[model samples]
Target: MGRIIAVANQKGGVGKTTTAINLSACLAEKKKKVLTIDIDPQGNTTSGLGVDKNMVENTVYELFLEECALKDCIQPSVMENLEIIPSNINLSGAEIELISMENKEYLLKNNLDAIKNDYDFIIIDCPPSLNLLTVNAMVASDTVLVPIQCEYYALEGLSQLMHTIDLIKERLNPKLEIEGVVFTMYDARTNLSSQVVENVKENLNKKIYKTIIPRNVRLAEAPSYGMPVNMYDSRSAGAEAYRFLAEEVIEREDEDAWL
Candidate 1:
C-alpha cells in the first residue's frame, strides 16, 4: 500500500497548499508515482498543478458523494508522474452535507483504500479548519505533515492542531502519526525566523524537516502561472527547498523501514 499523507494546517496562509503541490511534484520528479488529492474548497492545489477548475468533470466532491469511481476522478497533471483528484468551490458544501451521513468520517478513508496501491504516495491538501473534512483526511491518512510558517503566533496555532490530532488518534484513527513538521517562508536575514524555528523545535516532539522553505517571489508567482516552482524556476530558492524536502521525506521512509 502507498503512504497516504495529509498536508494540513488549521491556520491558513501557512503554505499548506504550496507544500502539497510542490512536494508532490518533487516526489514525482524523483520517479515515484504520486497522487495529490485536493480536499480544500479553495482549490489552490487543483490550480497549482495546472488543472483547470472550469473544465473538471469529476472531483473529490463526487468521490465523497460516491457519484463516481476513484479512477474516474483521477486526472493526470502537467507532470508526467503526478496525478490529481481536483477540487473546486463545490467542495465547500461537503461539510454540511456529510453531517447527515452514517460513518461520515470514514467516507474518505473507505474511498481511498480502493486505490491506495496505485501510487507510491497520496498527498491530501486539507482545508484550513477542524471540521468534518479535516477529520476525514486525518482518518484516511497514515500520517499528517504540518507546514508551519516562520512568523509570530506560529506555535500558538500549532497547539490547537496538535490537540485535534490527539483526539483523532484517540477515537478515530489510532494508526495516525505525525509525518513531520516543515518550516516555510523562512527569512534567514531576520532573527524572528530563526527564533520561530527554535521555538517550534523546543515545543514539538515531531521531527523538523531539515529543508526550510525560504520566502521566495518565485513560489508566489508559480501558482498564478499554473505550475510548480520547480517547473517554473528550478533554480529558485523555493524549488531547491522543496527538492530537498522530498529527499528528506524519502530518506525518512528508508529509516522507518529499517527501524
Candidate 2:
C-alpha cells in the first residue's frame, strides 16, 4: 500500500502547497511512482505541476460530490513519474455539502483506498483550515507533513491543527502518525529564524527534518509559472533544499526504522 502523506498547515502562506508540489516532484525524480492529491480549494498544487485548471475534465471535488471515480480524476503531470488528482474552485462548495452525507470524514479515505497500491507515495495538499475538508484529508492520510514557515507566529497556529490531528487519531485513523515537522522559508541570517529552529528542536517531540527550506524568491516565483523550483531553477536555494529534504525523507525510511 502507498503511504498517504497529507502536507498540512492550518495557517495560510506556510509553504504547504510549495512543499507538496516540489517534494512530490523530487520523490518522482528518484524513480518512485508518486501521486499528488489536491484537496485544497485553492488548486495551487494542481497549477504548481503545470496542470491547466480550465482543461481539467474531472477533479478531487467530483470524487467527493459528483460521483466521479478517484482513479479517473488523476491527471498525468509534466513529470514522468508523477500524477496529480487536481482540484479547482468547484471544491469550495464541498464543505457544506459534505455535512449532509453519511460518514462524512471517511469519504476521502474510502475513495483513496481503491488506488492506494498504484503509487509509492500519495501526497495530499490539505486546505488551510480545520474544516470538514481538512478533517477528510487527515482521516485519509497515514501521516502528515507539516510545513512550518519560520516566522514570528510559527508555533502559535499549530495548537488547533495538532488538536484536530489528535481527535482524528483517536476517532478515525488510529494508525496515523506525524511524518515530520519541516521548517520552510527559513532565513538563517536572522536571529528569529535561528530561534525558531532551536525552539522546534528543543520543544517538539516529532522529528524535525534536517533540511530547512530557505526563503527564496525563486521558490515563490516558480508557482506563478506553474512549475516546481527544481524545474524552474535547479541551482536555486529552494531547489537544493527540497532535494536535500527528499534525500533525508528516503534515508529516514531506512535508517530511523533501524534505530
Q: Which candidate tops TM-score?
A: 1
Each candidate: what lDDT?
0.92, 0.88
TM-score of 1: 0.97
Q: Which ten-residue region of model 2 has the weakest summed lDDT? A: 250-259
- Give lDDT tens digits, candidate 2, residues 78-174: 8889999999999999888887889988988998898899898999999988888888888999998899989888897787778888999999999
Query: Largest lDDT belongs to which candidate?
Result: 1
Location of the lowest summed lDDT over 10 successive residues in candidate 1:
250-259
TM-score of each: 0.97, 0.96
- Superposition-based RMSD of candidate 1 using all C-alpha atoms, in angstroms: 1.9
